[model samples]
Target: MVDVTELQRQHIEKITKEKKLITIKECSTLTGIGERKLRELVHVSGFPCIRFGKKCMIVSSLIDEWLINHIGETF
Candidate 1:
């Protein structure tokens, strides 16, 4: 059987290494935040983001920074 957690880690690593921007859904899944909450955070928190046409893209690096800043040593 496949280890789901490891698979998720691998996917995140791959995306980060590739410098791939992710959508709100993907970000929510990776960060365990709900879509509505993510949107509100982005709207209120001035989170780093890019909007291309109708789509919004969040950089993996920005997310990493936010995590490092917000999450304590427990992470």
Candidate 2:
């Protein structure tokens, strides 16, 4: 049987190393935004995205820019 803990650890390591792109869940966590809100912002405001096969990933750099630009401003 596969070791679930090892699998999770590997997944975490992969994500940490590939910081350029992230899932909606990761983006929401990093930006402190709800998943629904993040999706709306990405769709309406043209938030940066990186398409990988069938998945849509957000660029971490763009999230950093958004955070810097919106710092101290109420969401």
Model number with the top TM-score: 1
Looking at candidate 2, the ten consecutive residues that score lowest on lDDT are 38-47
Question: What's the residue-level lDDT of 61 in candidate 2?
Answer: 65
Models 1 onward score TM values of 0.74, 0.57
Per-candidate local distance difference test? 0.76, 0.72
RMSD of each: 3.9, 5.5
Writing each residue's lDDT as its tens digit, candidate 1 over 1-75 gives: 999999999987777778678888888877888898777666545577778886778876788688667765321
After superposition, the stretches of candidate 2 with alpha carbons farther than 4 Å from their true spots are 1-17, 52-54, 70-75
lDDT per residue, candidate 2, 20-49, as tens digits? 888899877565689988766665454688
* Residue 65 Cα positional deviation in candidate 1, in Å, after optimal superposition: 1.5
